[model samples]
Every structure is written in structure tokens, then in C-alpha cells.
Target: MDISTLLAQASSKWPQAAALSEPARDRHLTFRQLDQALTAFGQALERLDVGEGERVALLADAGIDYLIADYGCMANGRVRVPLDPTLSPVELLAQLRDAGAALLLFSPQYADVAEGLRGEGIRCRALEELTVAADVDLPDRPAQPPQSLASLNYTGGTTGVPKAVMHRHASLCAVLQNIVMARGAVLGDVLLNVRPLWPIAAVAVLAHLLSGGQVVLGGRFDSKTFIDQLAQQRVAFSSLVPTQLLRLLRETGSAPADLPLFKSLDIGAAALTGEVLDGAFSLFDGRIAVLYGMTEAPWSCYLAAAQMKALRQSGESAEGVVGRSLFAAALRIDRADANGIGEILLAGPQLMAGYWQQPGLTGEVLVDGWLRSGDLGRLRADGQLEVLGRCKDIIRSGGKSVQPGEVEQALLSHAAVREAYVFGLADVEWGEQVCAAVVLEGGASASVELLVEHCRELLSRYKVPRRLWFIEELPRSHYGKVQKKRLLEVLGVVAS
Candidate 1:
């Protein structure tokens, strides 16, 4: 089913229910009002000569306007390409060119950037300027097949250049159905969303809408503000990456008593160290789930709070437990070694059709019916999955493959360490040496010798980091994944 159909269903069933709201602006839309706005905006797009299946680029921050435009595009059968406003003009232009976007719709905040892109001969229009009369009749909704293209989602370009992952209406619907069924989401549920809407996290918005739940949109994440809003709105569900969770824990210092209304905090987009996980469970009196998926295929594996607690209490390592596969997906390890470490492979309806306009690159990853996830992981005897690290992130030290996640988790276990990132640096004799960057906890102190001694107790000699550097914070992508390439640049070393 198309997203538009889902929205229409929600609107009809609960016309008076709150559909979307921006608490910062004190603006909200009832289900009926949101549907009307989508229809009007869609009609406006038709008047602008935006043909069906044409690419329409949206460059705006997360707000009411972005949501309306997104839904409007869906209603009109336009392929929406949401761009990260945080990217440079050069980066944004590359996406615009890659998608062959015919028109750019942006918020007032990005007016200057829109003009700059327009100066490069791209057609641009401010979203505020695209208004239609309230009584204007919307054109007939196009009859789009389930397999029709819906959105072009671009990668965060953390490891390399960004590539567009093509998603169809059916794939997204399957993902939404799986989530709604798994979470038991209902009309009264409220999701507090603080991440930018351009990324796959926007799927949360769609999921809430599909389940007839309310969405509370916030601009950027401020730990104090987020917690305050969560309490004020009595939000039931939310998601965060590891970096954001760490910051929230540090800022709050202790859990507030008023956040009991919050039901679940779905953590994903990066790995959560054991220290962070422990702190999260202690601070939040709700489900703390670790979600494992990529832009290519969401809803692959979900480690729920019960499973997390069980693993902790049973003394099983929580370092890489991403739980079991979703009901709608199947997972396997390809070419597993003696330890069961291998590249993860997934097959399901939620998989992306292919990388946009990159047939060669698409063929490399998507083979037959499975997506080669390029992530190194192992399946436990209990059927749980442990994502070790990325295949490309393995460090070969003295002919031994060292998983960065294991070493980083050990460093994080140190009382003085708040965050740690491990990478490989070139060495003449060893070929590559394990190196680490660590962020110390507030007012905590530790020497390199002390940290090395600590690692020696837990890790093998070769698995321990050979070099370590203390830093204020590790570099992270917009989605909060550690940018190893940027770390190498920060350390004044080029990757070999």
C-alpha cells in the first residue's frame, strides 16, 4: 500500500486526533487537517507541472512543512528526494544532479542555499511560496502500483561517497506493517522524534502515521529540551543513536521520575557500548531496544529490552547482541569462519530494490534475492545475532584480524572512559596496527599506561590497541555512526 492510502485511512478513522505537531512552535495538525493540507499541497504540485514519477527534491529541516511536502509528494506519485540540510552546497548539488531533480522545494531557513543552487541552473522554489487556496480541489490521485518508486534515500556518506538507495512503496509498507505489528502501536501512542527527517529515521514518522499514532517533531536534539518535551508530551516511543544516548545520559546525570510515560527508546544507526547500555537501562525506566538495520533494508533485527536485560543478567556479552530477525525478514552469515564471524546477508520484502542509477554497484551487493550487508556478525546458538563490526573495519595486526568493536568495548569498560573508537593504522612490520581514540568521563583521569594495563586484563595481546589517543569526542556522521576515515584524518595519518 502507498503511504498516502495509510494517511487517508488514519484521517478517516480519527479525524480529530493529533497527527503531527511541532512543540517548539506550538503548531499541530489534526488527522483531518493534515490530510487536507496534503491534498492541497499535492494539488499545488500538479499546478506546477510536476508530472507523476518525476523527482522532486526537498531541502528542509524537520518540521510541519517537510512532512506536508513529503506526504503531498507521495499523494501525487512524485518521487521525493529528501536532502540533508547539514550537507555542504557541493554535496547537496551532487545529490540534486544525481537524482535529476527537476524542482527544489526548501524552507525559509535554506532560502540562501536554495538561491545558491538555483544560481547553478537548478530550479528552486521556497516551500512557503507553494500555497493553494483552501477550497482548491485536488487532482485525482494517480494509480501507482505497489512496486512503483517512492523515495530516493541517500546514504550518510560516512564510509565513502553517498549513494541513493531506491525504495518502493511496497517495501516501505512491508517495513511499516512489520514495525506496527511488532511494537503493538496504537492510535494513542506518541513518538518523540529529534533526528533530522532526511535520514531513514524518518521511517519512524511514517510508522507512527500508519499506526494512527501521533508524532512530536523537534528540531535538533538538546538533551535537556528532549527530556522536558518527553515528559510534557508523555511520549510513548522514541529512537536515538548511541552518540545521542550518551549525550542524553551525561546531560541528565540521573533519570527523572516524570518520564515513566515513555514506553520505548529504540536505539540504532550505531553500536552501543556496554557502558552506555548499562547506563541507559539504569537511567530510563522503559524499554531500551537496540535496533540493527541499514539504509538498504530496515527492520532486519531488533534486540528488545527484555532480551537485553536477560543477556545482562545471564552474564552473556551484550557487546554485539542485536537480537533475532524480524518476522518479515530472514538473515544468515555468508562464508563464516571458525568463530562464525562472517558477512551478514539478508533477504526480505523490506530490502531496497537497488542503488539508484548504479547498476554495476547494485549488482555487487544485491545477488539473487539477498543483500550482502557488508557487516561482520555471528549468529548465537540461541538464534540471536551479534554484529561484530563492519567487514571493512577489521584491523589486521600481525596477520590477526582484530574486530574494532571488541577493543572499543573493552576501552569503554574503563571507568574513566566515556567513549572509544578503534581503527587500524598502517605499520611496516605488522602491516596494520590497532589504534584507539578515547573520550574520558567528566573530571575522570587515566593514563595511556593505565588503559593499556586495563585492556591487557581483558583482551589478547594482539587485540589490545597498540596506540591510543585521548580526545574530547569522536567524530560522528549526522546519523551518529563513528567516522573512522575522519578519525584517521584527525590523527594526521592517511589510510593505507
Candidate 2:
């Protein structure tokens, strides 16, 4: 069934269960209350003359209002186009124009931007205004077909122009199923979601609710309070990007022993180096897991907590291990080098319908029913998937190809290197030379010479970074994936 049906089913099955919560605002909604709110917002959309299947763009922070707009748009057969608040108005406008949004709904914080969009001839409305109770009932609309559009999620635009990944009701339902199976969310499971609700993390929020579980929106993540919330809410499941996991480790020392209620923590959005994984495992008592996928097909692979413990006990490096494909997804390698690594290919019901309004671009990735995932990976004999870096991120140094992830992992193995990003810089002699931008642990320093020498011991000659820059933090997208293509511009380094 579709997302709307799924939420309705949850409401019917557990009318009194806590469906959503915002601890910061002391706001909470039970299943029946959430369903009513969704219905009210749907009626509001109808009153605004937004026809069925028309796009409604949501640009607001994660909270009760954003939640209503998101579910209401979908439940009422309207396509939800989520705009990243972190993006500039130019970028946001580009997506809005691309999606052909019938209306733009935003919170009070975005009033200035909404006014600017209105000046540009786009219809804008305050999200809270629409949340007011509608006295009249909205006529029941026919259920959309499973293939009907559900949302337009734009890419992170880390590399270049952002393309909206078109997700259908069927594909998103598949994602919900995969998440439930992979994360094992029980009826009473409590999931603390601090990640931005506009991205893939929002799916996790839906997955939990659809499974009759409670979701606590833990506003902006403050490591200190994050721990307190876990203990207070008895949160059993949570997800984090690698960046967030790293910060939690540094700021909170280790997962406090008092947090016995906390259970699963899945890390995704970027690869996890062995160093960070080990530290997180220690901090969270092996509750950490690895989730791998893209905007095109989220929840593709999952490295569960038990498997992570086994991998660690086996003394194998967990650096690139992103676990096995989910039950509904199939994965393969397209072309391979001598080392058996190649671009990862994914085929599944959860795959995005295509890039919205860009059939030609969609043709590039969706070929023969399998998504050309652009990510490089190799499969272990035991069926686990180990993702290398992106194929676009490979460094051609002196006629030899080097994967940046391998070098970055080696750099992270060093005591001082807290975070490392490896990329290629144009060089006349080597064609392209490996370069690095690193963030050291607090109060820790390492010479570029020392880091280079350390890499030489772990990587081949061509793979070691010839040049390195120490920075306070790596540039990242709102979703926490490193923006590799922007490192040079962000670091103010020019290619030789």
C-alpha cells in the first residue's frame, strides 16, 4: 500500500499510542490525533485550491507543523516537494520552479524568504496558518495508484546541479518495509530523530510510525541534551550520519552508562572509517550500525548491530563494510578492476521512479531496471557489501587509479587525524595528484609531513597524498555527506 494507507493503518491499529513528539516544544500527538491533524491540513490544502497531484513545497524545520504538511500533502494525493532550508534562495527557487509547485508552505522563520518567493510570483503561505482546524470536512479523494508521485527529493548538489529524485508511493512503501525489516522497529519502539526531516532521514521517521512506534523529534542535536533525551524518553532506536556520530563521541565522552534504554543506532550518509567505527562501537556499546544508499534508493543496505560485533570480533576491518542488501533490494557490481571493485548497481522496488522532469538524465542511471549507483563497491564472500568511494571521486595519480576512501581510512588510522577527506588535484607531471584536507582531534596537531609519511606505510606510492591541508572541519552537505568537489574552493587551494 501507499504511505497514506500505511499511516492510516497505524492510526487504526494503535489509536492511543504516541505517534509523534517534540520534546523541545513539549508537543506530542497520539496516532488518532496525528491522523486528525493530517486530515485538517489536507482540508486546508483543498481550501487553498491546490488540486490533487499538484506539488506543494515544504520549507520548514522539523516539528509538528512540518509533520502535518508533509503527511497531509501525501495523504491527500498531493505531491510533497521538500526544500532544504540550508540551501540559498537561488537554489531553493531553482527546485521550486523545477517541481512546478502549486504552493509554498513555510514556517514563520522563513517569512523573509517566503516574501521573496512571493515577489517572484510564487504562491506562499504560512504553514501554521494552514494548521488551524477546518470546520468543514474535505471530500474523500480516490486513492492514488501505487505508481503515483509522492515526493520530489533533490540531490545534495555536492558535485554539481541538483536533480530531483522522483519517489513514488510504491517505492516509498518499499523503503518503509525495508527499514522495518532492517532496523527491527517493534510496536512500542521509540525512535529519536534529530536529523533534518527534509532528507532521507524523514523516511526513518515514517517507517517507525507506520510500524506502530513512537517518534521523538529531538530538534537540533546538542550532544549533552541528546544523551539526556535518550534517557528521558527511553528512546530505543536512532539514526545518525557519520559526522553526527563523531561529534557525539567527542562531546559526550562515551554513551553514558545510564542510558540503558537506548538500543539501535544506524549510521549512514557517508562511509565510516575503521577508527570512527571502532570509537563509536566503544562509545555506544556496539549499538552502532551502518546504513548505505543514495537519494535514488535509500535503505539499500544495512549493517546491523550484531553483524558489526561479529565483524569486530573477527578482527576484520569494518572501514567500508555497509552490510548486506535489504530483503527487497538486489545489488551487483557493474565493471570491475583486478581488485574486484566496481560501480555498485542496485535493483529494487525501493528505487526512485527517476529524476523528476529529467527523463534523459534518468536514463543515465536507470538502465535495464537496475540503478547505476555511481558508488564503487565489492561484495564479500559472506554477502556483506563493502562500498569504496564514489567512481567520480577516484584519483588518477601518475596513470594509476586510487580510491580516496582507502587513503582517508589510512589517515584516520593515525592518532591525531580526526577526519580526513582525500581528493585529486590537477598536476602536470602526475596528470592528477592525490591531495587531502583533514581535521585533527581537538588540541591535537600533526605536520603534513608526518601525515604523508603515515599514509606511505599504509597505501601505495601513487595513493599517498602529495599535499595536505589541516582544517578545523570538513565541508559537508546538510545531510552530512562531505562535499568532495568543493574542498579546493572551500580550502582556498588551487590546482597546480
Candidate 3:
């Protein structure tokens, strides 16, 4: 189904139902209202002459406008490239310099951030000043053909340059299909977007909206606002990364006694620890589904909710499994020599079309109709997918190999530790040594000695951290992923 079809269907079938909300601004949308906004937006884009295949960059926080600009581009089939609202000027410029978008639809709140990138020579706008024609005649902007370019997903720069992965319209539809199948989400299912509007997670939220369920739009996941929305919006389902889920559980605890409205939570994007998952289950049992996904394909693989509860009831470690593959995506563990580890290969329509303008790189990963997920994972005998760690992120300590996720999971299990990251540091003697950085919970102190002893009970001697550094907070991206390399540098274990 094309984006135009999704919008048109929603407008026709659910004209009076709320389509979006900006509770903070006291602004909301019914289906008819959303339709008006899209028509006005399409007309406005026509005013700027945004034709097919043109790139439209949306630089804004998650709100009504962000979805508006995003859907507007989708409706007209303009490739939508979302910039993190929290990006620095340099960060924004790298994107601007790369894509050279024809039109930039930005919000006033982030207006200054956009202006800072003016040297890159791209047109930018505050959504308020942009309007449709007075007697707006909606120009019919067709959705891009299946083979046409649809999105440009930029990965964090490794060689000091961010690379955008491009996908065809068909591949984007595959992504939506995988998401719907993965979430078990179907018609009449409402989803919440309390996270950023970028990334693969956006695919799920958008599909829910397009499939006739309402999208409860909001900005950053403010604890109070989130709990209130979950209660008032009658939210059936939503998605989160582990970090966001941690904070949401804390907020949901303060939810009123009468509230039991939330049905399910789709969580992924970080290593799942026993403490975190158990804490999530304790807070919202039978409702949390930790997912294993990649931006390239199967945005979610194997949902570990009901399975986790069963495992817990049976006195087993439910946290060990990341669940089975979504309906469309599949996983297999072929590299046993790496200790039951294999490079995950995602094959399905859900895979991306290719990396934008980087055909060589795309060919390297998308081989034989499978997207080689750089993550190293294995499948349990019962068909559960267990992610060991990222291929590059796993630290090699004197050739024994140390999966930071294992050490971090053990560290998080400590009552005093709040957050942790495990990395290998250069060592003159042992080649590379395992170093861990941690944040103590509630500012409580814990000695590395205690932590090491705690880990020795659970992990092998070499798998434990040789050195530890305590920090107040881990450096995270806007999406709440710990930047390990950055952390190692900040702790003086590695050169910046």
C-alpha cells in the first residue's frame, strides 16, 4: 500500500476519530482535520514546486508538525529525510551537505538550529510561515513507484562522515509489513509515538496510523506526560528502547489506580539485561515485549513477552532469549566457532533497497537477498533468537573475546549500579584489557572490588572487567544508545 492510499483511506473511513494530538500545545487532529492539513501541505509543497524524487528534510521534534511534514512528503512521494532535532550545527550540516535537499520543513523552535546550516545553501522554513494557496487546490502528488527512492536513513558516521542508507518505495513497504507482522499489530490498533520521529521505530508508528489506528503524537517522553497520555489516550500499544522503557516504568508506577489501559510495549535497540527486563516485567508484567531488530531489515525480530512470562513462571532465565523472528523476517546462527555466534542475515521484502549513493557498500551487506546484520547472534534450540552483541562492539580481551552486553548485564544486576558500558582498552601487556564504566544508582557508591566479586559468581574470570570507571551519566545519542567509543575516550582509556 502506498502512503497516499494510507492517508486517503484514513480520511474516508475515520473522518471524526482523532488522528493526532499535541497535548502540550492544546492542539489535536481528527481524521478530517489531518486530511485538511495534508491537503494544505501538499498544496504548499506544490507552491515550492516539490516534485517526485525530490528530498524533503524534516528537522523538528516529535509533534504534530513533524508528522505533518513527514506525511506530507509521503503523500506526495517526496523522499523524507529526518534530522535529529537535538543535532548540533555540524551534525546538521553534514546531512545538508550530503543530500542537498530541495526543501527543508523545520519548526520555529528549531529554527535557530536550521539557520546555522545556511552556509550549506539549502532552503529552510518554519512550518508556520509555510501555507497552501488561499483557495488551495490540492495538487495530486502521486506516491513514488515501488522501485523509486523513498527514504535516506543516515547511519552515525564512522569515518568521520555519516552515510545515508537509501531504500526504494517497495522496500519501505516491506519494512512496514515486517513491523506490522512483528508487532502483531493489525487494523483498529492505536499506537503511541513518544520517541523521536526518525529511525526504524518510525516505520511501526506510521504503519499503525496508516492502517486506520490513531497515532497519539507527542514530543520527548516526559515522564508525567507519558503516564498521563497512556492513561487518557487508551493506548493499545507502543514501542521503546531499553533506556526509555526504564524511565517509562518509573513514571507509569505513579499512574492512577483505575488505569490499566496500556496493552503492550514493543522495546528494542539496546542490550537487554536481566535487571532491566525483570524491572519492566515487575512494573508491567505480560505487557513488555523486548525485540531484537536492525535498521536494515526486520525492525523487530522475535518478540519476547509471553515467552518471557512463561520462562519466568518456569524458573528459567527469560532474559536469555530475544524471541523468534517476525512473520516476514528470519534469523539463523551459522558461525559456531565464534561461540555459537554468526552474522545475522535478514532476508525478506523488509530489507532496504540500498545505501543512498553508496552502491558498493550496499552490495557488501545486502548479499544474496539477505541484509547481513553486522550483529552477531545465535538461535536457541527452541527457536528463540539471542543477540550476543554487535560484531564490532564486542571487545576482544587477549583473544578470549568479551561481549560487553554480558558484562554490562552483570554490572546492571548490581544493586548499586545504575548503568554500565564494557569496552576493551589498549594494554601494553595483555594486548587489550576489559574496562567497564558504570553509574551508581541514586548517587550511591560501590567499589570495583564488590562489583568484580558479584560478576565472578555469574561470569567467567576473563569475561569480567579488569578495570572500572564510575561516571555520573553515560553519553547517549538522542535515541538513548550509549556511544561506547565516546565513553572509552571520555574515560581516557582511548584517544578521542
Candidate number achieving the greatest lDDT relative to the actual structure: 2
Order the candidates by lDDT, highest first.
Answer: 2, 1, 3
- Colliding pairs, model 3: 166-356, 302-324
Clashes of 2: 0
Compose the digit string of candidate 1's lDDT tens values, residues 1-496: 8877877788779989988999778888888888888878877787889888889999988888888888778766888899988889999998989899989999988999999999998899988666432564344354467888988998848235569999888988878876776666787789988888875667767888778889989778888777887888889888877878888988886454467777778887356776777778777753677778888998788887777778878976576788888888999999999999899999999999999999999999999899999999999999989888899899999999999888987998888998888888889999899999999988999999999999999999999888999988788875577887778778777885
Question: What value does the lDDT take at residue 224 in candidate 3?
Answer: 60
User: Which regions of candidate 3 deviate over 4 angstroms?
Assistant: 130-143, 157-159, 185-189, 250-258, 412-414, 453-459
Clashes of 3: 2
Q: Write the per-residue lDDT of candidate 3 for residues 1-496, one digit (tens) a residue.
A: 5766667777778888877777778777777777667777766787888877788888877777777777777666788887776667778777866886887878878777767665467788787555332354344445456777777777754336677877666777777766666566655666778888785556677777666677877667776666566768777787777677667666666222334766677777345566667767776656777667666764647564676678678886676477777776766665655466777767777677777777898889888887778877777777777777778776666677778887888898888998888877777777778888899988588998999999999999888888988898898765567777777668776631
Q: What is the lDDT of candidate 1?
A: 0.83
Q: Which sections of candidate 2 miss by over 4 Å? A: 133-141, 158-161
TM-score sort, best first:
2, 1, 3
